[model samples]
Target: MPTTVLVAGFRGSMGQKATAMIKRDPELELAAVYSPHLETTDPAAYDLPATTQVFNQLSAMDTPAQVWVDFSTPAGAFENAQFALEHGMTPIIGTSGLSDDQVAQLTKLAKEQHQAGLLVPNFGLSAVLLMQFAKQAAQYFPDAEIIEMHHADKKDSPSGTAVNTAKMIAAGRKQAPETVENPVETIPGARGANYEDVPIHAVRLPGYVAHEQVLFGGPGEALTIRQDSFDRESFMHGLNIAIKQVNRLKGFAVGLENVL
Candidate 1:
């Protein structure tokens, strides 16, 4: 049987890409769509099957889907995930800006419901491998920093990818490493945000799609792991994998690395 999927923010770029990918895969089915902006009674209006339901809100979805794919705004991500869990649907969240407390709450909810809640920062397969490589490198060189670059329209400052990488590196270490001494800056905020003593620098520019570099330094040399996504298609492959495997994951998982 095809896995039923409800896509929130189906009109947006990532959402649209996910929708098309889901439709193409024989293992997946488009059960419904939720978009706050676009409205249409006809399913063909969004290139979906006529049988698929369109909803402006979660409450309007009369039938519960097995999976909820969220690529909406930060404000909408948490609510969509909660709604999915409450309705016994697994949520695969692609949006950022969820706080630690909010994640905890959602994880608890998923546990109670015996469903999975996934918060994926970046669904690009190469990006997931980059994070894994960074974790491996961190074991040898504990002194490291991350720089993540994204398009200017990105809502978050430090990309979730960078934050997740830092956390993963921290997890691999038995003890916290000493902080690096920085050169004095004439301007404040010159140094990037610190996550578990790891510096994260975020760059938002017009031309870049998505890029990340993790640099680790020791006494003699430094190791750098970099990955770049020139287009949105880089993410869909990993998204498809998540949609297929989420049901088997019966608790909250933070990254696509878990599925990989």
Candidate 2:
């Protein structure tokens, strides 16, 4: 039987793409779509069946689903996932901005319920590969900085991809990464945010989809790794993979790279 999937945040950029991708996949069923702002949008605007229900919350829906693929906002992501877990459904979360405490709580809930939950920071394959490559490169370079760029409308700074990359690099390195010393700070907050001693710079502007670069320096040599998402479709390939493999997981897994 095909996996029954409900998509939350169906009106957002990524949500719309995910809806279309799920419709095209024969192995998955588009069970329903949910968004708190559903009333403000037109149903005809979506490319779903005329019979499909678009509700504001999971509790209001009567349709049965085994998994909920949530690309909602940070505020809604946790609530949606928690509702799914409570209803005996697995949750696949793509929304960023969830705190570590929230993740820990979700992990504990998933473990208690014996449900496989997936919380992916970024779902683009090349992005995931970039992170893996950065981890491998960190051991050699040991000093790195990240610059992540996205469309101006992106809700979060330091894209989850950049934070995850920094963590991976920190894990792989032997010594602590270096920071600029005696830097003249004419303007505060110019150095960007630091994660595990690695600096991450966030850039938001128009005409860019999603892009990130990791630059490493050591002993007169430097290496750079970059990943770019030209369109939302770049993330679909990995999302499909997650949908197929999440059912087999014993507990919660973060990052699409874990399943890949």
Clashes (N, CA, C under 3 Å) per candidate:
0, 0
Best by TM-score: 2
Worst 10 residues of 2 by lDDT: 38-47
TM-score of each: 0.94, 0.95
Among these predictions, the greatest lDDT belongs to: 2
Candidate 1 lDDT over 105-139, as tens digits, reads: 99999999888879998999899999888888888
How much is the lDDT of residue 172 in candidate 2?
A: 91
Candidate 2: stretches off by over 4 Å: 40-45, 180-183
Assess each prediction's global lDDT (C-alpha) against the native: 0.87, 0.88
Off by over 4 Å in 1: 39-41, 180-183
TM-score of 2: 0.95
Candidate 1 weakest lDDT stretch, 10 residues: 174-183
lDDT of 2 by residue, 1-260 (tens): 98888899878999989989988998988888898776533456676787566677565767677889999899999988888887888899999888888999999999988889999989999999999999999988889999999999997988888988998999999887676688876888788887888889999999999999999999888999999999989999999999888988888888997787
The clash number for model 2 is 0
